[model samples]
Target: MTSMIQELTVSHNPFDMTPTMNYSNTTDSSFTNNSSTITNNQSYDGVDDFLLPWWQQTVFFLALIAILIIASGGNLIVIWIVLAHKRMRTVTNYFLVNLAIADFLISVLNMPFTFLFLLYQNWWFGTFFCKFSCFISPCTISVSVLTFMAIAIDRYMAILYPLRPRIPRRHVIAAIAVIWIISIALSLPNLIFFTTVEQSGVTLCTYTWSLDKDLAYNYLLLILNYIFPLLTLTITYSRVGIELWGSQAIGEETSVQHDRVKSKRKVVKMMIVVVIIFAVCWLPMHLYFLLSNHHPAVTKLDYIQQIYIVFFLMAMSNSMYNPIIYCWMNSRFREGFIRVFCWCPCRPCKKFRSKLRFRRTLFPTSVNAMSEKYSERNGSLMHTMTEYVDPDVNGPRRVSNNRNIVRKSDDYL
Candidate 1:
């Protein structure tokens, strides 16, 4: 009788309604048949039928749990190593410390909820957690991404302009502060826009902004998360590769070819691998979100389901991969990991002894031997000159004359 019921009847599947309907005024057989037809055409919610099993949930959560263990433990170690080791306290390392902090926060905040959300298949967390969790997710991600970009830019500056003054400590601190400020600003939208809803008796937490708003948010998210960062990382790393490889090809005599140089070159290669992985792992998800801006019709059931699964898996996978990247590709991170896990035996005492040993061994007996040789040669030349002059200019050479000269010098003093 009404447009709402008419639209609902047209949109939903038939044969899902209850059998009893009190059409008390319908006496005509045609009206009774129309009432029966309308009753048969009603449909109830179908989300319960579509719910996935626990194991069928995002595989990314399992991966995220594993990474959480490692990242929590690994990042703590990095923080300790960077703080304890004076060598790691440079301006660049300060940025690294912030990056580690960001990673740690992500693991602490994002990974556990991810596992729980996947297990439940719907938001079991209350309204507070739903909004808080969603809000923190974007913040953590933004911090991580922006930190990586900052590190890339720092590396580029270090390589491209080595002679320039080191980035000031104050500036590094200021940059980190700015990053947090911007990250919070980006995440602010989630707190405002995300909501929990009860649709057909199933309560769910989702970003329920309309198509236009979601598109704008998605486009901004993609730009912040992927496009600009990917572009900067790609170009900077490309230039770094060219610069380092070009140096390797220069005249060997002019260069200090050593294992240390080779090790740094290897580090550059590893950084490139990290950048590539960052791009490859995250690009598709961003592209999907970006294309979602078009608000394509989801009339096909399969397409909607597939999109949901793909994005869910993509997000889960993204959260789990960062620590693996750090461990697999970064030697500094590996070393910090070892120290963090207390793998080095008696590290503090060993470090002290190592410094003492280095100080003792730095200069050897060869240096003293050269000094002795020079002294002997100078004394012999003086003796030969004295021998040549004494017989012609003086009366005779005598031991008593040398004793008399010493006595005269003592009396004068």
Candidate 2:
């Protein structure tokens, strides 16, 4: 057996299998065989050697399926709530709608392929998916980060300068368009640099770049997607926290002012939690890539492949988390999600209608009582009284004597 193995090696290499063997003058056949042998050996190095047991594979599969369901369902709920309900269409929520769209695309387009790639260690999909996935997966993530940044800035402006006029709806739309454009442009290089290459008997979808260029690109992504956004969120939220919670005096603490402050603080806290969760979920994946690229020897370790899979799943879970955060932290979003999913049956609808009816019935009585009181006091009827009902929330506001003046509700804020 030893002699046969030696003969096979000699036939493949045609030279002594020593470090000192010079290959410049070797025949093409021998060089090809040697290269093929090395490639075949490397193909089984990482995932194959540490392949999980059947039960573990089953658990992993179930986990990925759960992620798929949660990511898709949760993000779709966010999108629907924002789009279907006028109450949810604030400037900040519009950015969130953009975020939901990005996460939805990631959940639908990227997660399944990623699961297959990790499980099989090869790209079974054709070249089209190879390039398409490479371009879109990162693009969605970039959009998410950019959208988060936009939300942070929007919050910063609203909290820091409450007196200034809010950003216009058109400007918010333009910002969203710019975010998508920038995200696509950032991912364009993936279409050029990524392709499917055959290794051993399997086709692997990967980047085709020089080592230096690959490293540079990876670092660029780390900075743009992770580090810079994290810093921006940290600083902006820190300032927002101070503004909301710090020693700002409220000289006249009316119920309306108190509710406004509480609402602002709640929003700030929810956004801060979102930023922290994003950083936590994504940090491991970025660190894994950085370490693998900078220290190739780590890839040869026994459990390195498993660690990489865990890191990837952690990163992908980010797509599922924001909707959960929204549900848990914001009552309005929670109510919206409940309404979207019909989780509460007819209770919310009945309550909403009852409130509207109550307000409608009460407003006219109050107005009539006030008019009678005014007539008794002033000996004249007030002809300019106007009752304004907020169409979105179905709440009746106070009647005013100002003509042609429309009152906007602050419920969205």
Candidate 3:
């Protein structure tokens, strides 16, 4: 999740607006016609002026297309896993699935046109697609980030206080709906401020905002992209760390506590790593934009300013990397991944199936099959390893034995 992603290439103007020079003779003695009526044409050649050298624009768009394809494919796999596996379904993972869905839509919507725009720096898809695509990209990114924040909070609670009741499925659905509604609300600015303008006979997709709205736009982006969400992460993780590690009872255990300690530590470490990666990838981009807004003079540092665009794109890509981390670092996810990939041996699969069948027969109808399966498998393991008896046993054998003992006591009396 924390690896260095490839950066976006530098953007250059696709159209040539440079002036052409015309040469003329100063004096001609033999010519009867007037010698000097030269017209200056400022108009640029459509084909010649926009003639892109072979290696630059086309190839770059192709690379973007490749990334888009990978992102779309990978997100689809995640969605499939979440949907097909009942074990993968949870209030938290439900949100994650929604996030992936949004991100997949964003990748599908933005990347193709992004390539088109890069190739010509023009909007041939008309004003509607341009506005729609622009709105969708940020909307998805917002959903992705906010969902991550929610997940972090969920994880913190799960780890720090495992005894508490989980957030319900209905609220999770409601929360995801609200997130989308808010994301769409934030995206409305694009619908209002984006337009297609004709310049030098070429249509360009660009932001069209009044000066007052530009400031508002920058402020809104800053808040939504960085400030508010970082605050959420900071507060949640801080409390989580305190509750996990600050308890005296856990710290005081000394004899045979290594396994519990290590397991606890692993969970904490993974969350910490996730938080750090999110911070590292996004903080710089937000700071760059925030500073740039405050001091327009910072634009004079062209190279430094260019770095911001690269970082922002990198941050966007971070949305997809969380699932990879979950799969790698979390044992439950690793098992799910193995099952999905069909890496488990046939023997294990058969045994697992037998266990499932046993659970279904034992539990009958009242309990959920999945919960019954989990309980049966674990209880079977414990039963195999240790001796246990039912406290409520009142079978005929026990009743007969009790009667015999009482009769013998009466005979002795």
Candidate 4:
């Protein structure tokens, strides 16, 4: 949160990152080591004001820790799954890689720092980090939303005109570079203006911009990061939805065509779900800021801090969902996760082995054992036999000959 949150001292919205015009008591101590009482005004009760009950605080800490572990671990595996595998190097997966990178960066940097910033009511890290933290927050968010928009457009192009040549890997590389450039450009103001300011007796990391300027930039963020992307996705995905489900499959009802149509539907549905989640998670935060800004008196509500915590958690949580969603919806990703788990001796994925056993298509060394048991079982190929695993192809005993056909998605999805 920026110094705008500093206004929380006098019964204001403590979590508001928009900075307000203010004077400081201490000289610039951003780079220099100063032990002043550092706190972000996002908390009405400053650093010394740890008035919340222990139970209430415990829930918040636990939630933050959960987010840190899940976001980091999940996104790390997603990155590995895409980069480490050859067949997974598809157009959409590349965009997913960028999305995962942004989330990973946020998970590692934003979650812990923000949690500590709230709990201790102090900025333990130095001034450089103060600015870096604020900059990276918006930058990563922009990267995510922008990447989502790009996916929508790419899907629009690929589906609406299937025969058209898709963007090459090199151009996608350039597009990724451009996404970061725009994100950095949009967030550069935060890097420049947000610094640690010692106000009254407490130090806060904030921006010193006047009210109009600060709110104007915030409005930009709201539009570019939330509103515009939402509109774009709605339009593009609407057309994509029409193209995919609006018409029947172009062939006689057969297993192959049904599978192709189903795969296409699955990919579209997965992307739509991801877009929906992005909208749901960030909507509250944007609405909260708008509500507080328009009606300043709202901040005086007794449970306002509690309200902000929920919105903040939802926003922070946006970073962690992409990986789980990928593994849940995409077949290749699920297999890759299983592979990673198999390699690790500790077998962190053991807990979820039962869940993954059904859909995943795995190559086990115990094929002979499975073949021997195949005669005993009825239609079980993988789960009951415990040899070949692919949850998607749960149909009649998957004839081994058609295995390659199921793995490829670019053909239809």
* Global CA lDDT computed for model 2: 0.62
The prediction achieving the highest lDDT against the true structure is 4
Scored by CA lDDT, what does every candidate get? 0.49, 0.62, 0.51, 0.65
What TM-scores do the predictions have? 0.65, 0.76, 0.63, 0.76
Runs in model 1 deviating more than 4 A are 1-46, 54-61, 114-121, 247-263, 291-314, 329-332, 339-413
Leading candidate by TM-score: 2
- Worst ten-residue run, lDDT, model 1? 9-18
TM-score, predicted candidate 1 vs. hidden true structure: 0.65
Which digits, one per residue and each the tens of the lDDT, describe model 2 over residues 67-94?
A: 8899999998888777776655678788
For model 2, the superposed segments whose C-alpha errors exceed 4 Å read 1-50, 343-413
Q: Tens digits of per-residue lDDT for model 3 on 1-413?
A: 43322111111111000001112122332211111111213333342333346665455556555557656765776677667755446665587688779768866777566545544545687889767877776687678778868777776765565546767778888988888988888878776767666655456666666546645665676677667887888888778667556654423332212333344455556655755666676665556555654554443343432243245345545555665766666554554555555654662532233210102112122324212221121122111111111111100011121122211000000
Pitting candidate 1 against candidate 4, the one with the higher TM-score is 4
Candidate 4 accuracy as lDDT: 0.65
Give RMSD (Å) of candidate 2 vs. truth.
10.2
Write the residue-wise lDDT of candidate 1 on 72-131 in tens digits: 766676667667755345555676678678667756765576445433335566677767
Cα lDDT over the full model 3? 0.51
Write the number of the candidate with greater lDDT, choosing between 1 and 4.
4
